[model samples]
Target: MNVVLSAVSGISASLGEDAVVGITIVILVFLFSMQRFGTDKVGLSFAPILILWFALISGIGLYNLVKHDIGVLRAFNPKCIYDYFKRNGFKQGWLSLGGIFLCITGSEAMFADLGHFNVRAIQISFSSVVFPAIVIAYIGEAAFLRKFPDKASNTFYACVPGHLYWPTFVIAILASIIASQSMVSGAFSIISQAQNLGCFPKVKVVHTSTKHKGQVYIPDINYMLMIACILVSAAFKTSTKMSHAYGIAVVCDMTITTFLVCFIMLVIWKKNIWLVALFLPFGCIELLYLSSQMTKFTKGGFVPLVLAFFLTALMGIWHYVQKERYMFELNNKISVESLGKLVNKENINRMPGIGVLYSELVQGIPPIFSHFIANIPSIHSVVVFVSIKAIPIATVALEERFLFRRMEPRGHNIFCCVLRHGYRDVLGDHEEFEFQLVHYLKEFITQETIMHEAEATTTTVEQITSIHIHTNENEVAHISHGYTIDDTLTKEGKHSSNGSSSGSITMLRVANSYSLSSSHMEGVEKEIKFIEKAMEKGVVHMLGEAEVVANPKSSIFNKIVINYVYSFLRKNFRQVDKVMAIPHNRLLKVGMTYEI
Candidate 1:
């Protein structure tokens, strides 16, 4: 509504009101459509225009200061303000305070844009360009109001020099557009951060620039905001009505920020209690402003409160459901002892290539894997259990991302790879993840070979190599108190006198990708070549598709939360594959049902 009013007022004030509403809607749609292009290209174009705006307003204010009564300078005195407020008393002055609050409506953008611009840059801009310009502009308007007492209500437009009114109107419109862009961008950043930390449902995030790490475009949020703004503009159709809602939102935003900062000071920073006491006066001032705005509750002030409440409730539900689901998975996970026993069954067949299994469990194997093995006869030659874990920090270093653990004895080839990322970490493309996983696995295999060689120094090189080769194939599926991988090697698949294993070790083209550390590199290279061949065969992703439902005996509230709200949110959110950027062609999903 404020957007439409600003545009209509500018057009009516400058170009005459031929089709003000139509013009306003068209300009708004154009601005929103330009979001896809991003602000990187357009920001520089707006900067010079904003600079000229500040210069023109400041110049006009200086001119008015000289021409009109210089006594308006007395407003800087604290006693004058106190006396004026004292004369007006609580009832009248408190009501007028609502309009005064609108002056700082977009102040939240300063903190929101901290990620895009440095703190020092923001401080410099506010102190130099924004602060003085705002002060002079208001003082100049006050001077005009004092000189022409009848024009008190419309002093801003009436006082502008006749020839410069249209130019100022154009500049004002552009500034409003920039302000709207900042608000939209800030909303996107907050939503993205919330999604990362599991406080909000997953949505699509598209990085806009390769050079700028934080530049992002969220199409879902952009379209939603555009539609909302249009609806608001249509509904209110005037700034007078919209200002109430705008004031409520801004006041609540400031109040919440105040509380958050106070919490950080006391709990996070551990500032002395006396030092923190200084903020109490500031909090009281904000509370007074909030109390003044509350008087407009029936006049659109309730809109922002309703919106805030709904969003807060939704975020809370999402966080609760996510935590509950994770706990359920953890409690139901398959133990290593149970899985090892099943792996020993001779009837299970080992297929070619690698199967990458994604699970929430960090320690035990997911029960979904057990279900998959029970139903399917053939498992992969090498299986990788990948767990993507989110840490509390801002970002995890790339070198510390992948932590590899061999689940079984050396030759088994089954491994666990944990991918740890901080809340702000960017999860890059699938190709990069696969490349890193392969690199780390190769390094682990090299270390394992060196450690084995050091332990069995008395054994002949041929004996060690043959023992390693035999253990690799047999030990993977069998686990018991007295069983060893070497025991099953003599059962079958013995190499002929030609010193080559049977059909299992069929010759294949080897890619010279790995660099070995040991002098006896030939034997290790053979093992790596075999693993590379398996990789070339293909890599498949196994995703667990679990359906969450409420138990029959559960209360109505639990049923609604678990079976309705949770289900709806999950259906709307991005799926695991899309979030992780996994390829669809090689993916397999195993289904399970849970009653929680």
Candidate 2:
């Protein structure tokens, strides 16, 4: 077994230092470019070419079979594996076991290209082309080993006639380079998911070029992986050595997935052991077996483990920051008395104006929304909108209707809308979504009425009418419309919760994009200008869109900047009163109440 591993590593290394360099360069360049060419083209161009490469590999192995002299059948011997293990003892036995797990370096490809191929297509491709190629390539190497007892360089190349050896080596390098594309694409998909869940910082993703939702690009992740792969490929200088770094992350992720799968089943499926056992154990055993085979941690397997820590730490910090923000909002409430006095002193006149403030939070509904509603009690309506992230491609069965059932209840005379996007869509847009929602509610609302129904399927939950008004984009002339994403949505992909847009309420929405700190201010000026214009038109009750910094440092930092800018501006312009708060955080939620 040790002899075989040494031979394998020697063969891969003999491809030369330049070949590994060539492979890494090929990998990164092709990887970034793949986002544009897409999955179908990759399949179109590479699939057939890979088939030819496999055929040539097999032919070389079969030709060498006739010349084999040292126990020709040893090439076909399973007993040799047992005998080698028995002689080498347990420590060396485990070393032999390590050789088998290298096959999974490309396992991420299965997940990365999941968008390109349905489960069935990938199964078929693996069974027909990929599976056979792996088997024959090993067998071809084994056949050559029987023919030549002690060749130091690649047996696969030496087995070829002298004229074809270098050419075949070149072919082998190209195959390894192409294999790196799968890893690059896989990293893109993982980081994108992290961004959507708010577990990682937002990175730009491109979606329009491919039908494959998994096809994406993250500039940071791309650069990071490129540097890491090059360093390892150079340090180890062989796929066989880098193989250790590759499989550790794969095994741990597999273990994590298995556990997550179990949790999803137990909690989501009500702890149905039979279904969990029946469906999960097979995969569980396979990954565990792979992990056991990957026991060579000191030999380079620790690379992926190191990476896992970084990811976990990043997500942990993000969640902690958010929890701190909620603590502030839940504890603070603005005053209606001061807000009411401000609205009246301004001496504004309009029929009735309303603004719906949207926040991408599940908790700590901003106090501003409530302050405005309470203060101006007579100025039309105000809505506090909270958005929820969606779960894509949920297999809840098409016949299984009733997509979501929101059991929690609050908000009297309020409007709430649940928005979900497709799996393919990665971006979330709140302000533009408000216009569509306002247009939707206008269809059911009446002029003098103040009641409306969101969905009228259940007789008991009838419609509640509200005032007739449209939140038009033209009202805020200079603010640019937000961006929309192409997500393959479930019933509740992107969510927006709308409460009443009543009175001269300060519907303050804190925490807009770019930075949780000062970046929130990037959109604030535009928001403020919009509010100011409404005020000039005799429609100024109070409405605002601001960001709540999740971290205390950020919150203090941002609020200080905003207060400084705000105080200077107010003294230069006009002074107002009162503030509001609404729920906005990880889960799509918000609450209405005034903050003083």
Candidate 3:
């Protein structure tokens, strides 16, 4: 929005003010519309143009330095700065610092955009060109102002040579657009990180580039920013007033960043005390600038603080509620021992195929799983409880990604698999997860077979017969699901004379029970087959769609926070299923209400 205003003012100064507002609106609308298409196509174009703009400004500054007062070089001396401060005294000099702060208003944006490029690139660009160009341009403007005190108010335009005004105006507009892009990109990155960290609600995230994971577009955020930008531009109508609010925002951001850096140095890196102490002055400087800006509170500086308050409150409530919900799940979760006993009960039906139940709880059973089994009579032959956990790292290696634990030893057919992912890790689709899970199960079976061989244990005929019965149970489940069998299979007795699979289902059943060792092999093979069949039949994602409500006995504040504020946020935000990319066809949402 400020970009639009900057462009409009630059063009208006030379081309008159009649169409400036309309042109600004058109330019902004077009820029916002182009967001969906992404910046990949135009990102490269910006680099050269920005470089050219810097070069042109630097060149202009050099020309102006020689043409105007070369005495501006003296202003760079520390003695000159001290003399100016001494001349103005404490109160007046401090007030002047507020206006001086505007010179670096949007500088924080460079650091915010650090994710898009490596630190080396930023450092090189800043040191080699950007820093020097900016310094020269400011010096050139100051030199021009010194030469013509009457034209001090219009210094930038006045510094421009008559012949270069139109060209510089065009470049200035382009530069503003590029600057606007940086701001928009930085906001998207922050929102995306917030969502990943559970500090903000999940919105739709569209990857703008397959090659660049950092490039993203969020429609909701983009529109909101555009509307805010437009409103600010419309209301403020000039750069002077807008600078007050902008300076406050930038200074506050710097202050927050300084504190964060200090924390990382102290807690994360455990840096030397002297190294950490170096950051104290930076924090103080930022706080000083913030204090200076706050003096203009009545002149629109309070706008950023208000915006910050609302965003902070929203994020804080979300984080608090999420923590509370996790705590509740922890306190009320069903134990693994209890689940094992329930599965072993004679009344429970152990159906065929595998069931993958997604649970938030890393240990024990999620309450939703108990509710599901209670309501639905049939249970899968092999049930796996899957928990996805986010680790505080940039990436997790595949070798360390999955941690599998068996619920019970020897044929219990229940397991718990914990999947660990980093905040920036890419989770492959459901099919990939299923494939990896099955592959790991196969590895487990092979290792168990090797261990049994090493133990030199021999299975008895009764064990073989028990394995046969288990196979029959699976066949029974398959038949119940509308499968047909031949009449010859139906005619077979409890014990078959020959172990053959030619006749029907009954023959196939006895063929797998001929010998104790073969029975063990057959059982393992059947389990694998059952898992493969289940995969083909499709995976079902069972999620607890919980609604949080305040208990009637609670205080008014609690009621409002839970029932109104949290509820409203949950209603508007995308749910976990959508964020995790669960398929709609396979998703089974078990709705539940929780009173807190």
Candidate 4:
């Protein structure tokens, strides 16, 4: 942002420093205000402009390289770097690296944007367009600098031909804005991911594009980034100092990414140790760059450090408290048997509707459910424990997304469902999710009934024939709704040799006898009808509102974080119901306190 203002002031003699600052603030406000339109819309409009900008710069660089000293390309040689350090001394060269590092400052934005675009798209764009354009532009600038050393401070504008100066200036301004926009979008992506992973406080994340799941906009993050940029631009008031701050942040980011990649390679991928060890040299290079940027700490590098410290601390506190809260829930979770006993012994009223209990637990019942039941002495006729889980993948297949398990003591009509979504998956609205949930629930019940009937028939056949019949239980269990005795028996039973036809006929007759009873179909239909009736009564989304407090035995610091900082954040941030997109009319808040 400071760079944009500097470029503007460079082209306009009338605009003073204060005027430049005002223009920058206005530009930032406008830029951030436009974020609600979403990254896809913004990217669509900006893409052509950026492409043109890159092409223009590339053309200018090629022209300069051809017209001026081509020998400047020799700077690419390692010998030139070694000679420079040898001549200028290590101290000056080390400090100069701070400026050199600025060239790669915006590269981290690509990594941050991986959620928005596919790996192939990013790689193709960078390798074919961005990389070549940058290299040509840099070499062109160097050639122009070699001819007129005095213009080194502003090589970009100085290299532009006199006739195209104003046009180039306009393009430069737009390009800078687009660059900053990418960084802003990247911030939103990072924060949203962190929040999903329970590392950050819940914030309102609006899906901007219906077609692209990752195109999201966070009003809070946008405005915060805008204000921070404006303040930094105003405070620094010059590009040179901002460059120092920018270099440190970029290098630190690169170093962290390197470490993360190494971990993924060694642990997650289980790569050969030698192959993973190769990244150590690259890591060392990043550390060196980081160390060089540290020399500018007093100049401006401390800015990012301070911001990083605060953000890291905030995330740490939130994540720690969340983990503690999860542990408390896990430890105190109520068993299905216990819940059944409680309800039966207490004579708890079974309400008409289907109650969808939202929880973080995938297996056992959450403590909040028991708490709600104990307090109200009632529960919905058909209770569904729904836990939304985020898996570490791009997107899960729709068919494989929801896993349903019937809670034991089938009379309770309780079911546990886990909806697994990948990190980049977009959750549908309440109505769509509710529809899918109901469909899956009915399907689950149907399959379970058929499996039970099949097992019974298999037992009866064994008893009558006194002959062992081998069948794949899993094959029978997973049969679709169009249940047929022929299909089920064909896939399930293995007939004996001597009485093969007889055994097959016998098994078929026995299966037919069971099917003739219509018990399986009746049971399935009964459950389906019950669920439909419950739906008519309405589906209630029960969300737990956990009041987290630090344990009394905790240290002062823990108390301050949990009872004060974490509590404040939880209260202020968007609620879980809103994040989950639960319908307000159907939402039920179940309050529970956790001393963790």
Candidate 5:
């Protein structure tokens, strides 16, 4: 931003320092305000401008290379670097590395954009276009610098031919803005992933492109970044000072990435240790750059370090609190038998509606459900425990998205559903989500009925009729045919023998006739009809609003994090119901308190 302002002030003599600052403020506001339109839309609009910028730089570099000393190409050789360090003192050469590190500042943006664009497209463009153009542009600048050492401070503008000066200046400003936009977009993507992984507080995420699930916009993050950038630009007021901060941040990012890649190769991929050691040279080079930048810590390099520490602390606190809350729920979850006993109590009422209870648990009843029943003494006639899980992938197939299981104590009409969504999958269409949930539930019931009937056909009528009767919902029931219904397999439809024998007598009669009877069909139809009627009554989205408080026995640090910082973030951030896009009128919030 400072560099662009300097160019602007250079073009117009009347534009003073204050005027340049005002211009920068306006540009930053405008840039961040455009984020709501999404990455795809923004990228399309900036594509032609960036292409022209790259082409112009490439042409200018090639022209200068042919016109000036071709000997600058020797800088590519490792021996030239060795001689330069020898010619110049070692300390001076080491410090100069901080300036050279700025060249790769925006390279990480490519990795950040993998979610928004295709990998093949990024690889092809970087290898064939971006990489070559950048190399040519740098060589051209160096060659021009060799001829006129006095213009080293502003080599980019100084190297431009007189006739094309204004055109290049305008394109340069636009390209810089596009670069800033890429970092902003990457921040949004990172925060979204963090929230999905429970490492960050929930924020309102808008899916900007219907066709691309990864194209998201978060208003809160955008405005925050805009303000931070404006403040930093205003403070530094010069590109040279800002360069120190930028160099350190980029080098640190590179070092971390190198470490992660080495770890992945050695551990996750199970590659040979020797192969992993190959990355050590690159890691050492990054460390050298990092150490050089560290010398400038008091001269603007502290900015990124401060910001990184604050963000890391914030994320660490939120994740810790979330993990503790999850542990509490996991330990306190009620068994299916206990839930059945509570539901069958005479005082408890099963209301006529379909209730979709949202939980983090994939199996067993979340403690929130029991808490809701304990206080309200009522539940929906048909209850579905829905857990939305984010799997490590780009996208999940539609057919394989929902996994359904019938909760035991079969006649209670309780089911457990695990909806598996890939990291890049969008789940904002409330109407479609509700429709699919019901559709899959009905499908699961039909499939299970058919499977059980098929199994019954192979069994003897005596074995089926003589099945031991067990009325207690809390105990395991032994079937005459070596089948046992254990209370542990709460996820029905997953195991055939885990099913109840409530309709076994009808199934046996139908099997004896060597055909499925309408009576047997009616039994399955009855359950489907009940579910449809519940849906007709209306679907209510039940979400647990947990108020987490620090345990009394916790230390001061834990209390400060949980009772203050974590609480503040949770209250201010977007709530789960809003994130899920549930209708306010149809939503049922179950409030509970947790001390953990």
Candidate 6:
């Protein structure tokens, strides 16, 4: 909406404000649809050259365009606006307000593109290229419009002579296409993030390229958008009609961000009440301006609301179900423990190894720790990691040595790893992190002269056994909505026997039978309490969605041990549910796992 407002307000003199505002719809469509391509192809290949081309060509025309209007500067003054408004009256004001819908549509682009192109890069691009160009064009257009109002047609196409019109239109179209590329790319990035956090469901994801995390392709989103573009174009008949649909999505999205920010302020930042009070009321004013747009709802605002609401609701549901499933699985796995009982058990205290409990959320108490302690009653002397990280993609570099220390609290053998990103950065090694870990660990542990058990006089040494309980691009922990080609065929029940799909994802049911890991040390029930306490310790980091799959070699389990544990684990891993998006249609069954 800001884009549209800026364009219209600035260009109204030459293009006729309505013309610029109208052009924004097509430009927006152009921007959102062409985003699936890799950025090097888009930005490096097209953006730099094209942006340069835009400047070169536009710059060439700037002298002539600006020559007509010495008085164009009047529009920029606050005082001139008061005179123009007195002349035009409230009808013009309301029309301007109505048209302002064009500006707010892409508001989600900010949050959706938060991680991409770097925040600095986006800010720079906006401030440098987009902003200045718009200013020049609007000023030039205003001069043209004021000189010969006939040239200021509401349609950009109508402004040019018959011969030059097509060429100008074509150039304009090309510009629109480039803009679409930016937006669509942004949508893919946002949806991917949402999917990672269970704000959305599974889609066939195509990483746009190896290097750029921002360039992603969701076949579902693409197709949905394609259809939506067509439908919107046809139904609205003009950009003006579609303009009405704009504010709903943008406003609703902003509202969500506002609420989420509030939560962050309270829970994450722990800010003072007065500070929250100061800024929130101001933000509310912005929110109200966006919300007031809903008055145009019947005109065409319902579409985006429906689109975004379905998205929000689907995300909310996925979050709910995923949380529910985690609880259910956890309940079955963890055994209750009393610290006093565990400390007294002489043969069952502590273990010589590392215990890294991996989970999507990593609840403070997990079932497996006590279960391990109960069976391995003699297991003690262990270093427990309670990781607080999300999977899918955002992984901090391992070299970030600062992170490991950030997790350590009050100094104990237990070192916490509060990695900020998904699985990759947490699982992989970073140079700085390795150096920091070596120095910090050595310093912290070296003083404790004895190792392992007390009788021998040596301390127990434990390797940092880091495992990534992965959340796929869909952001699911375990395999609640997945299936491999093998499983798909088998589930098909012998009709298409022995067929193999190379692209299929065979999700092993995690909480059910197949995905469960059964081996445990013996006679360690006495130390169980400490392990349970350690389960949620900040050291055990994890990601929301990851590629750390079940051992592929577990084909042995696929055959021989397919009975009890394997089936239970596999139950959690199966892709039994899928939610189609864009238009929000429910196609597959709620728990129907699919292959490919």
For each candidate, the alpha-carbon lDDT, in order, equals 0.72, 0.47, 0.71, 0.77, 0.78, 0.46
Give the poorly placed runs of model 1, Cα more than 4 Å off. 1-4, 13-20, 149-153, 210-212, 389-402, 409-411, 419-440, 451-530, 551-554, 580-584
lDDT of 5 at 224: 89
Clashing pairs in 5: none
**Model 2 residue 453 CA deviation in Å:** 11
Sort by TM-score, top down from the best: 5, 1, 4, 3, 2, 6
- Deviating ranges (above 4 Å) for candidate 6: 1-37, 56-67, 100-113, 150-155, 158-167, 251-292, 334-456, 460-596
Worst 10 residues of 4 by lDDT: 499-508
Question: Tens digits of per-residue lDDT for model 3 on 122-208?
Answer: 889888988899889988888887778897655776788989988887887788888888889888888887886778877887667
lDDT of 4 by residue, 1-596 (tens): 65566556664446676777788788788889989988877787678887998898998898788888899877888899899999999988987887787887777778757767899999999999999998999888888887888988778888888887888888888887788777777788788888877999888777676556567789888888888988998898767778888888889988998999999999999999899889888889889888888998999889999999999999999999999999999999988778778768556998999999888876788898878987898899999988876554455556445667778688778888877665456674888888888987886676456455657656443433222122233422323222222332332223222212212222212323223135555666788899999888989999999899988998999899999999889888887587668778899899988998
- In model 5, which range of ten residues has the least summed lDDT? 479-488
* Cα-based lDDT at residue 505, candidate 6: 25
RMSD of each: 10.5, 13.3, 11.6, 8.3, 7.9, 17.5
Residue 487 displacement (Å), model 6? 34
Please provide, for model 5 over 1-596, each residue's C-alpha lDDT reduced to its tens digit, 9 standing for 90 to 100.
Answer: 54445445444436566676677778888889999988878788678998999999999998888777778998999999899899988999999898888887778878767777799999998998899999999999899988988988778777888898889988887887887777777788889889877899988777676566567789998888889988987898767788888888889999999999999998899999998898789999999999999999999999999999999999999999999999998998889889888888998998999999998887778888888988999899999998876654446556456667789899999998877665457787888898888877876676456446657666554544433222234743232222211222243232222223233112322222233346665776798888889988989999999889988998999899999999999989887587678989989999998999
User: Per-residue lDDT for 332-416 in model 6, tens only?
Assistant: 4332234334434676655444333333333233344444456556432334333334434423333221122212222223443
Total colliding residue pairs, candidate 2: 70
Task: Tell me which of candidates 5 and 6 scores higher on lDDT.
Answer: 5
Instruction: Estimate the TM-score of every prediction.
Output: 0.82, 0.60, 0.80, 0.81, 0.82, 0.53
lDDT of 1 by residue, 422-496 (tens): 545666577677767776676556545544554455433222221222233343211111111122223323323
Q: Model 1: C-alpha RMSD to truth?
A: 10.5
